[model samples]
Target: MNKLNNYKDNEYEYYPICINGQIFNCFSSMSLKDLLLYLNFNLSLVIVEYNKQIIDKEDWSNICLNINDSVEVITITGGG
Candidate 1:
Protein backbone atom coordinates (compact mmCIF):
# COMPACT_ATOMS: atom_id res chain seq x y z
CA MET A 1 0.00 0.00 0.00
CA ASN A 2 1.29 3.42 -0.86
CA LYS A 3 1.36 5.87 1.97
CA LEU A 4 1.55 9.63 1.79
CA ASN A 5 4.71 11.22 3.04
CA ASN A 6 5.94 14.77 3.21
CA TYR A 7 8.46 15.69 0.59
CA LYS A 8 11.38 18.04 0.98
CA ASP A 9 9.28 20.87 -0.38
CA ASN A 10 7.26 20.78 2.86
CA GLU A 11 4.35 22.38 1.15
CA TYR A 12 2.78 19.18 -0.14
CA GLU A 13 2.50 15.48 0.56
CA TYR A 14 3.01 13.05 -2.25
CA TYR A 15 1.92 9.46 -2.75
CA PRO A 16 3.15 6.99 -5.29
CA ILE A 17 0.68 5.36 -7.64
CA CYS A 18 0.94 3.23 -10.75
CA ILE A 19 -0.97 4.37 -13.75
CA ASN A 20 -0.68 2.06 -16.75
CA GLY A 21 2.53 0.65 -15.32
CA GLN A 22 4.13 4.04 -14.85
CA ILE A 23 4.79 5.55 -11.46
CA PHE A 24 3.35 8.98 -10.77
CA ASN A 25 3.46 11.32 -7.83
CA CYS A 26 0.16 12.63 -6.57
CA PHE A 27 -0.36 15.30 -3.99
CA SER A 28 -2.94 14.47 -1.39
CA SER A 29 -5.91 12.16 -1.91
CA MET A 30 -8.36 12.52 -4.75
CA SER A 31 -11.34 10.90 -6.38
CA LEU A 32 -11.41 9.34 -9.85
CA LYS A 33 -13.16 12.44 -11.10
CA ASP A 34 -10.32 14.59 -9.96
CA LEU A 35 -7.75 12.29 -11.47
CA LEU A 36 -9.42 12.40 -14.83
CA LEU A 37 -9.57 16.15 -14.72
CA TYR A 38 -5.96 16.34 -13.69
CA LEU A 39 -4.93 14.16 -16.59
CA ASN A 40 -7.03 16.18 -19.02
CA PHE A 41 -8.94 13.17 -20.13
CA ASN A 42 -12.19 13.46 -22.00
CA LEU A 43 -14.57 11.76 -19.61
CA SER A 44 -17.09 11.06 -22.33
CA LEU A 45 -14.59 8.99 -24.33
CA VAL A 46 -12.49 7.35 -21.74
CA ILE A 47 -12.80 4.14 -19.78
CA VAL A 48 -11.24 3.72 -16.40
CA GLU A 49 -10.15 0.51 -14.73
CA TYR A 50 -9.37 0.90 -11.09
CA ASN A 51 -7.45 -1.79 -9.26
CA LYS A 52 -8.21 -4.24 -12.03
CA GLN A 53 -11.94 -3.59 -11.82
CA ILE A 54 -13.93 -1.72 -14.41
CA ILE A 55 -15.47 1.31 -12.75
CA ASP A 56 -18.68 2.87 -13.94
CA LYS A 57 -18.71 6.53 -14.89
CA GLU A 58 -21.36 7.38 -12.32
CA ASP A 59 -19.13 6.06 -9.55
CA TRP A 60 -16.05 8.08 -10.48
CA SER A 61 -16.87 10.90 -8.08
CA ASN A 62 -17.43 8.50 -5.21
CA ILE A 63 -14.27 6.44 -5.66
CA CYS A 64 -11.29 7.68 -3.75
CA LEU A 65 -7.81 6.74 -4.90
CA ASN A 66 -5.30 5.32 -2.46
CA ILE A 67 -1.56 5.18 -2.55
CA ASN A 68 -0.11 2.50 -4.84
CA ASP A 69 -3.46 1.93 -6.45
CA SER A 70 -3.24 0.66 -10.02
CA VAL A 71 -5.29 2.55 -12.57
CA GLU A 72 -5.67 1.96 -16.26
CA VAL A 73 -7.26 4.53 -18.50
CA ILE A 74 -8.21 3.85 -22.08
CA THR A 75 -9.26 6.56 -24.45
CA ILE A 76 -11.65 5.86 -27.25
CA THR A 77 -10.63 7.16 -30.65
CA GLY A 78 -12.53 7.75 -33.79
CA GLY A 79 -11.46 5.93 -36.92
CA GLY A 80 -12.81 4.24 -39.94
Candidate 2:
Protein backbone atom coordinates (compact mmCIF):
# COMPACT_ATOMS: atom_id res chain seq x y z
CA MET A 1 0.00 0.00 0.00
CA ASN A 2 1.16 3.54 -0.68
CA LYS A 3 1.47 5.10 2.74
CA LEU A 4 1.90 8.74 3.58
CA ASN A 5 3.56 9.99 6.75
CA ASN A 6 2.36 13.13 8.38
CA TYR A 7 4.32 15.63 10.46
CA LYS A 8 3.30 13.76 13.59
CA ASP A 9 4.91 10.61 12.25
CA ASN A 10 1.57 8.93 11.72
CA GLU A 11 1.40 6.75 8.62
CA TYR A 12 -1.78 6.56 6.60
CA GLU A 13 -3.03 6.21 3.07
CA TYR A 14 -5.84 8.43 1.94
CA TYR A 15 -8.04 7.81 -1.05
CA PRO A 16 -10.73 9.95 -2.60
CA ILE A 17 -14.10 8.35 -2.11
CA CYS A 18 -17.61 9.49 -2.92
CA ILE A 19 -20.26 9.04 -0.27
CA ASN A 20 -23.83 10.08 -0.82
CA GLY A 21 -22.77 12.29 -3.73
CA GLN A 22 -20.09 14.04 -1.71
CA ILE A 23 -16.38 13.48 -2.11
CA PHE A 24 -14.31 12.88 1.00
CA ASN A 25 -10.83 11.70 1.80
CA CYS A 26 -10.94 8.25 3.34
CA PHE A 27 -8.32 6.12 4.98
CA SER A 28 -7.37 3.50 2.43
CA SER A 29 -6.62 0.87 5.05
CA MET A 30 -9.90 1.12 6.89
CA SER A 31 -12.66 -1.41 6.65
CA LEU A 32 -16.30 -0.43 6.36
CA LYS A 33 -16.69 -0.91 10.12
CA ASP A 34 -13.78 1.38 10.90
CA LEU A 35 -15.00 3.94 8.42
CA LEU A 36 -18.44 3.94 9.98
CA LEU A 37 -16.95 4.33 13.43
CA TYR A 38 -14.75 7.17 12.24
CA LEU A 39 -17.82 8.88 10.85
CA ASN A 40 -19.72 8.38 14.12
CA PHE A 41 -22.44 6.34 12.52
CA ASN A 42 -24.81 4.36 14.65
CA LEU A 43 -24.23 0.91 13.33
CA SER A 44 -27.62 -0.35 14.39
CA LEU A 45 -29.54 2.38 12.65
CA VAL A 46 -27.87 2.59 9.27
CA ILE A 47 -27.84 0.65 6.07
CA VAL A 48 -24.63 0.79 4.07
CA GLU A 49 -24.20 0.48 0.35
CA TYR A 50 -20.74 -0.05 -1.03
CA ASN A 51 -20.03 0.45 -4.66
CA LYS A 52 -23.76 0.41 -5.40
CA GLN A 53 -24.30 -2.89 -3.64
CA ILE A 54 -25.81 -3.28 -0.23
CA ILE A 55 -23.36 -4.85 2.17
CA ASP A 56 -24.36 -7.06 5.05
CA LYS A 57 -23.53 -5.90 8.52
CA GLU A 58 -21.68 -9.10 9.24
CA ASP A 59 -19.39 -8.41 6.30
CA TRP A 60 -18.60 -4.82 7.08
CA SER A 61 -15.38 -5.59 8.85
CA ASN A 62 -14.14 -7.65 5.95
CA ILE A 63 -14.56 -5.09 3.20
CA CYS A 64 -11.60 -2.84 2.62
CA LEU A 65 -12.14 0.60 1.10
CA ASN A 66 -10.46 1.48 -2.16
CA ILE A 67 -9.73 4.52 -4.28
CA ASN A 68 -12.68 6.07 -6.10
CA ASP A 69 -15.05 3.74 -4.29
CA SER A 70 -18.59 4.87 -3.62
CA VAL A 71 -20.60 4.48 -0.43
CA GLU A 72 -24.15 5.37 0.54
CA VAL A 73 -25.38 5.50 4.11
CA ILE A 74 -29.13 5.32 4.61
CA THR A 75 -30.42 5.97 8.07
CA ILE A 76 -33.46 4.13 9.32
CA THR A 77 -36.10 6.35 10.83
CA GLY A 78 -39.35 5.44 12.48
CA GLY A 79 -42.21 7.85 12.88
CA GLY A 80 -45.88 8.38 12.30
Candidate 3:
Protein backbone atom coordinates (compact mmCIF):
# COMPACT_ATOMS: atom_id res chain seq x y z
CA MET A 1 0.00 0.00 0.00
CA ASN A 2 1.28 3.45 -0.84
CA LYS A 3 1.49 5.84 2.06
CA LEU A 4 -0.25 9.19 1.86
CA ASN A 5 3.09 10.92 2.27
CA ASN A 6 4.42 9.27 -0.86
CA TYR A 7 3.18 12.18 -2.94
CA LYS A 8 4.42 15.73 -2.46
CA ASP A 9 4.10 19.00 -4.30
CA ASN A 10 5.88 21.91 -2.66
CA GLU A 11 4.55 20.77 0.75
CA TYR A 12 1.24 19.38 -0.42
CA GLU A 13 0.24 16.03 -1.82
CA TYR A 14 -2.91 15.27 -3.79
CA TYR A 15 -4.43 12.08 -5.09
CA PRO A 16 -6.41 12.54 -8.27
CA ILE A 17 -9.39 10.28 -8.81
CA CYS A 18 -12.42 10.14 -11.06
CA ILE A 19 -15.90 10.14 -9.55
CA ASN A 20 -18.97 10.02 -11.76
CA GLY A 21 -16.76 10.98 -14.72
CA GLN A 22 -15.39 14.03 -12.94
CA ILE A 23 -11.86 14.51 -11.63
CA PHE A 24 -11.27 15.29 -7.98
CA ASN A 25 -8.17 15.84 -5.91
CA CYS A 26 -7.97 14.44 -2.40
CA PHE A 27 -5.34 14.68 0.27
CA SER A 28 -4.33 11.80 2.53
CA SER A 29 -5.20 8.16 2.17
CA MET A 30 -8.87 7.40 2.73
CA SER A 31 -11.29 4.55 2.25
CA LEU A 32 -14.38 4.60 0.07
CA LYS A 33 -16.52 5.17 3.13
CA ASP A 34 -14.55 8.27 3.97
CA LEU A 35 -14.83 9.51 0.44
CA LEU A 36 -18.58 9.15 0.52
CA LEU A 37 -18.74 11.08 3.74
CA TYR A 38 -16.49 13.76 2.32
CA LEU A 39 -18.86 14.13 -0.57
CA ASN A 40 -21.82 14.51 1.79
CA PHE A 41 -23.41 11.26 0.70
CA ASN A 42 -25.74 9.34 2.91
CA LEU A 43 -24.20 5.89 3.07
CA SER A 44 -27.48 4.06 3.46
CA LEU A 45 -28.98 5.79 0.45
CA VAL A 46 -26.25 5.41 -2.11
CA ILE A 47 -24.66 2.77 -4.26
CA VAL A 48 -21.02 2.80 -5.19
CA GLU A 49 -19.27 1.48 -8.25
CA TYR A 50 -15.56 1.11 -7.89
CA ASN A 51 -13.35 0.48 -10.85
CA LYS A 52 -16.37 -0.59 -12.84
CA GLN A 53 -17.41 -3.14 -10.25
CA ILE A 54 -20.36 -2.90 -7.91
CA ILE A 55 -18.88 -2.78 -4.46
CA ASP A 56 -20.55 -4.30 -1.43
CA LYS A 57 -21.34 -1.78 1.24
CA GLU A 58 -19.56 -3.85 3.84
CA ASP A 59 -16.32 -3.54 1.90
CA TRP A 60 -16.34 0.23 1.65
CA SER A 61 -14.13 0.72 4.68
CA ASN A 62 -11.57 -1.72 3.40
CA ILE A 63 -11.26 -0.40 -0.11
CA CYS A 64 -8.55 2.19 -0.32
CA LEU A 65 -8.66 4.57 -3.24
CA ASN A 66 -5.74 4.90 -5.62
CA ILE A 67 -4.65 7.61 -7.96
CA ASN A 68 -6.65 7.74 -11.19
CA ASP A 69 -9.09 5.18 -9.85
CA SER A 70 -12.58 5.40 -11.26
CA VAL A 71 -15.66 5.55 -9.06
CA GLU A 72 -19.33 6.11 -9.70
CA VAL A 73 -21.83 7.02 -7.01
CA ILE A 74 -25.57 6.83 -7.38
CA THR A 75 -27.98 8.24 -4.89
CA ILE A 76 -31.25 6.51 -4.27
CA THR A 77 -34.19 8.87 -4.31
CA GLY A 78 -37.82 8.32 -3.51
CA GLY A 79 -40.41 9.19 -6.11
CA GLY A 80 -44.15 9.04 -6.31
- After superposing candidate 2, which stretches have Cα over 4 Å from the reference? 1-10
RMSD, candidate 1, Å: 2.7
Candidate 1 Cα misplacement greater than 4 A, ranges: 1-9
The C-alpha stretches of model 3 lying farther than 4 A from their native spots are: 1-12
lDDT of 3 by residue, 43-76 (tens): 9999999999999999999998888788899999
The prediction achieving the highest lDDT against the true structure is 3
* Global Cα lDDT for candidate 3: 0.84
lDDT for each residue of candidate 1 in 1-80, tens digit (9 for 90 to 100) = 45544343557666677888788777656788898899899999999999999999999999877777888999999999
Stretch of 10 with least lDDT, candidate 3: 1-10
Better of 2 and 3 by lDDT: 3
- My TM-score estimates for the predictions, one after another, are 0.83, 0.84, 0.83
Model 2 steric clash pairs: none
Report per-prediction Cα RMSD to one decimal.
2.7, 5.0, 4.8
The clash count of every prediction, one per candidate, is 0, 0, 0
Instruction: Rank the models by lDDT, top first.
Output: 3, 2, 1
